[model samples]
Target: MNFKIFPALVLAAAVTLSAPVGLQAQSDDPAAERIPIMRSNGMVLRAAPRASGDEAIAAAQTFVDNFAALPALFEDPAFPGNTQPAAWDNFDAFVGIFDEARQGAEAALAAAQAGDMNGYSAGIQTVAATCSACHGPYRRQ
Candidate 1:
């Protein structure tokens, strides 16, 4: 097997292994669920560069769905490590950023459906920037 494909295969395996199974009860902590979702998002983003039009559209749609759900997850009282008053403030700001990213992902999905590769690229860039902006201040190192 080509070494170039090896790492991708490993990553795919890791993601598959880490994903929550339907038979297993997930943690009540939002962070526990969020970690795997974020890892899957990274996988989709990484694959987007090489994906075909249909694949890109599917990936973008998944991103849109995931980001749309993020605000509720972040706002959940059971979300881990968000007990402080300032954390709520930070979460509010992060929600705005997440909304922006969701919009970007939606745009990417539209662009893919419309066969506009350039628009899709730009949308992906916007989404990436939004993620980085939120992570810079909020994500635990």
Candidate 2:
């Protein structure tokens, strides 16, 4: 057999053999559904800094709403790479952080509605801290 043709044939065979495994691995990843939610959450976070008055209130409300659902999402058995039993040791704590974030967001919303920039700034800070606290311990770097 010609060497060039032989290499091409071997490459094709290898790809065909690995295709199912690759597909299966992709299917096994549980983050696919969660990525969009994360992106939406990011959009709300990004908007918060630029928004003021009603816009800020709206953004904060959106942030609170998204985080409110996180506990249920995180509790899902199919939550991305959350397969290891040890990963769930602090599951309740992780969920609790979202509650804290929701409260922060609510405070931000109230401050925005009242046109209190100082309070809004403080509320935003609280929300950010909550995110950092949870991510530091639970999220993959």
lDDT of 1 at 40: 63
Model 1 TM-score, all chains together: 0.73
| Candidate 2 lDDT tens digits, 18-48 | 3233223234443554455566666777777
Residue pairs in collision within model 2: none
The Cα local distance difference test for each model comes to: 0.73, 0.68
TM-score of every candidate relative to the true structure? 0.73, 0.68
Q: Which regions of candidate 1 deviate over 4 angstroms?
A: 1-27, 81-87
Pull out the clashing pairs in model 1.
Answer: none
Instruction: Specify the highest-TM-score model's number.
Output: 1
Number of backbone-clashing residue pairs for each candidate, in the order shown: 0, 0
Q: Write the per-residue lDDT of candidate 1 for residues 1-141, one digit (tens) a residue.
A: 999999999987875565433113344667556765677678888987666589889788778877865665566555655233444667667688888998999999999999999888888888888866877677765
